[model samples]
Target chain A: MRAACHAPIRGDFTGLRGLEWDKMLHCPAQAARAIPTISAATSMSQTRHVFFISDGTGITAETLGHSLLAQFPDTRFRNHRLPFIDSTDKARDCVQRIKDAAIESGIRPIVFNTLVDPSAVAALREADALFLDLFEKFIEPLENELGQRSTHAAGRFHGIADSQDYKKRIEAINFTLAHDDGVSHADLAEADVILVGVSRSGKTPTSLYLAMQFGIKAANYPLIPEDFERNRLPVELTRYRGKLFGLTIGPDRLSQIRQERRPNSRYASLENCLHEIESAQRMMKREGIKWLDSTAKSIEEISTIILQEVRLDPQSY
Target chain B: MRAACHAPIRGDFTGLRGLEWDKMLHCPAQAARAIPTISAATSMSQTRHVFFISDGTGITAETLGHSLLAQFPDTRFRNHRLPFIDSTDKARDCVQRIKDAAIESGIRPIVFNTLVDPSAVAALREADALFLDLFEKFIEPLENELGQRSTHAAGRFHGIADSQDYKKRIEAINFTLAHDDGVSHADLAEADVILVGVSRSGKTPTSLYLAMQFGIKAANYPLIPEDFERNRLPVELTRYRGKLFGLTIGPDRLSQIRQERRPNSRYASLENCLHEIESAQRMMKREGIKWLDSTAKSIEEISTIILQEVRLDPQSY
Candidate 1:
């Protein structure tokens, strides 16, 4: 089956309703194939050199490349990123590197490029590899649809062109940094959203992703043992109850994550994880707050769900 | 002019050249168009609601929206994001919210959606807005080209399917957090690349971006005042000279940035910024280190250039 198989909304798929923590971990595909694979060739596939080359941040190329590569699970990949190759000479150097990688791996490297400059793109095309030019593939179709030619820009996708947008993102990032880990609740009023969770519950990364990607001032507060013991929301968070979003993790997963941070301690114990998660969920339910599980989800999934729930303005940072 | 106009590599365009600090700030676009506009419509435009509705992170929708909106700078946009709308009921709520936005603003809102679920997409189509379904627009053409039907997956784009890739990214992020700001250089050899820059030269954000986006275990070390006085590379960095990539900024811009952090102090003074930048540049030149200016660049640009220069394996992290 393709990796892009649709994960049916099996658990608490209710829209805008209370997103259950446990129900969110349901993976339909995993249930269909519960047994581990015993294929020997899966481990012996030739390691191919995959390159995500771009003329900007290389983020789009990486994202697209990863999505495509995820389809072939048996193929072993060694990825090398080549970003901001705008000049012809840099492109030539990139070609040399690709050739070297191909020689070292004894297999032709796969190149995924979004180069805007024709000269640079041409130089890399000469390399011995299965070259995939994303811009070359889609720009023509888009131009035909829009009835206008593309600018062939290099840095505009994620560049600092609009100072206003740049300032908003920077301000949001700084705000997130300042409000991280319940560091300060004095300026909670300024926050667009406040995330509450126990330690190692994917709060920090989710908060940063929301700030960086959507320009939302996301402030995260850790629900410590004291907060769980009190059996109530903190006084600072009481005023911003409407902006509160909760994150919970499975006890097993939470225990493993905490063990990495603080090994052989009460905090890392499975019992402690279960206790904290149960208390946090009870408090969240009592206070009428929506929650989601972070154990089976990525930071992108968590942040996207939060944004959908709150309906915050993405461009109003 | 669209903000997507290609930035011609005018100043110091040579590939991997000296990369002079002051020369990097020469933005030709700014030169061609200077001074704030006295146009009154810029501030008085009617505010319009924009929504990037998706079943994923809404990143692609946001990118397309921003690029399209850049062509019409006079339009004041208030963007709200609605992601992970996988059910028909949630789609109804989204339509209601869109209608409410139109009612409040007295203008039909603009909605850019990439909804994968057909039922959800249908419900959203009933909303009173300029609905642009990016998926519906291009999916058929892509299907025809590939001779295969798309999975119509909702979460596959950003889902946690490949546990290995997810683990590598999380590990890289952990490594970056542990090694931030020269906190611990004990495991510096494990880093794919090490960034060296003076204070506030955009090291932390760039380091985090590299780690999170490309799965590169990036470590950054700040060039302190004593190092500048000594006029030599730090002892800890000398061992990883080949892994070193320097970041420099224009003195005036550096002073302005510093002033924001420590207002009205010697650290933010123009003289101090100039001295540090000059000394840092001289030291970098003497050591034959390749550097880029962060004065007018974004973290994305800085990180992209570093990746291109170092050619680190993105998947090895």
Candidate 2:
């Protein structure tokens, strides 16, 4: 990886110096426009580079970095993850790579470091970039607040506390997978929440998200035309009224979403969508079930709201 | 929420004052051991309270805070998330809750904040707690590195970007869902990667993660007894050789995992697991297919290694 980065910098810089200073700046931009790969090596504004450096799996760094970067949608970034940078040698090599990237791109890369070792962190600080140390910024304050010093351990963030947590999450996943689309009636009562909605109304994703993120057993049952026509909850769900959460979408949006799956069908028609949604909404209201319009909500927002309303904590089993 | 917090504080603190000074502190610890919920309210050493405060979905704060807290596994935390604190009044309410928590618990709380607006952030800072602001700590350095100011806009982190990104992810998900278990051979060629594995070998979660996180269209096909008996790749998979990635598991682990799903069946038998794994490994090696043992890895780890090995960038379409 180091050789790959350095190889491009040495070759590019030598060729860059042969041209006049003014042309040197302009030539790369023109070449970059013509060739997409050259954009990272030429224009700083054209590409923003981000490196998530961690001593473990780098998932946490990537998750936090991605969330932060998502706020800047106008900025385009090329991302890289360097996980298991625990030693001083690896940290030094990482710094060199960042510097080489800076030399080649005329852009300093942003480094999100979760490196806990002081020496390794210091080595990375020498790089020609913005080094944001996640631990350094918060650890001391946390220690003082808690009246305890941190262990500064690596990989603990992802280490299975016991087989229990792993088992719980997997069981939730398996339950969510099995109970999907009301496939199994036996486990309906076991679900923390039963999500009801029209087809493609974001039930599958939301159920999976709830199970995966919060260890909540979420079972989703689609409200079909039969149930809509009857204007009643499914017989199996009538017993678990307290666990039911309803999801509805705008009729036009539902039509558009369904049309993509099966075009020109009655199932994907706007009339069907309106009828199903109206019937489902009426049923939910009559039963005093809280519901959300999922047409404009992201899965995260929808899941968060549901979790809050249900009083489920992500940490609790 | 405000009423809930203040009600507890008013009830708990006065009772705490009536006890002897040293016993007031020690009594809570004793009470905490007897009562788990009291651990959050009484003993500082017995339990740590953490607040992930954000002006958005709070995913970033929860993720980073969880990672940091994971290091101190010995310390138990009672966590609360306060999202969408977009106004000063909301911020003030948040501070009041934090202050009340401190009064009730007899310990200061640790706050992980992602507040962007200056006034809202300042209001949160006034609370008697350890305030670790993610944006405040890293944004200025990022600005210096990029030679530009940040927009600090709320909701952009998760806002739908011209519907293109949302569409691509959803399409990938739909494709993955459709192509799951080799349900549709017609679109096999459209997949960016195809996962071949045995039953319950972590294929479903891995495929979903790749599609949802990286926007990679992944299809998974199970390696069955037929493929094992023949000691060859499936005929349907031969055409998309370059896109094939294999997942294997330790026989014992596989048996244990499968036993939970279908106890005492041939599918969950140790003999069946050994035969399947041995045959699959031999076939994968003979076919020059890259594979990984998923027995000891999480879905995140499995998906990440696959993405890295294939050199797929999540940022790209």
- TM-score of every prediction relative to native: 0.71, 0.85
Q: After superposition, how far is residue B303 of candidate 2 from its true place, in Å?
A: 1.2
Most accurate candidate by DockQ: 2
lDDT of 2: 0.71
TM-score of 2: 0.85
**Per-residue lDDT of candidate 2, residues A179-206 (tens digit):** 9889898867789899988888889888
Write candidate 2's Cα lDDT for B99-212 as tens digits: 767766677888888888889888888898888888878777766666667888865444454477777887887788788888889879799999988887889878877887
What is the Å distance of residue B149 in model 1 from its true position?
5.7
Q: True interface contacts reproduced by each model, as a fraction? A: 0.13, 0.24
In order, the first chain's TM-score in every candidate is 0.79, 0.83
Which CAPRI quality tier does the interface of model 2 achieve? incorrect
Candidate achieving the largest lDDT: 2
User: Model 2 chain B — which ten-residue stretch has the worst lDDT?
Assistant: B23-32
For residue A10, give model 2's deviation from the true position in Å.
19
**Clashing residue pairs, backbone N/CA/C < 3 A, model 1:** A314-B79
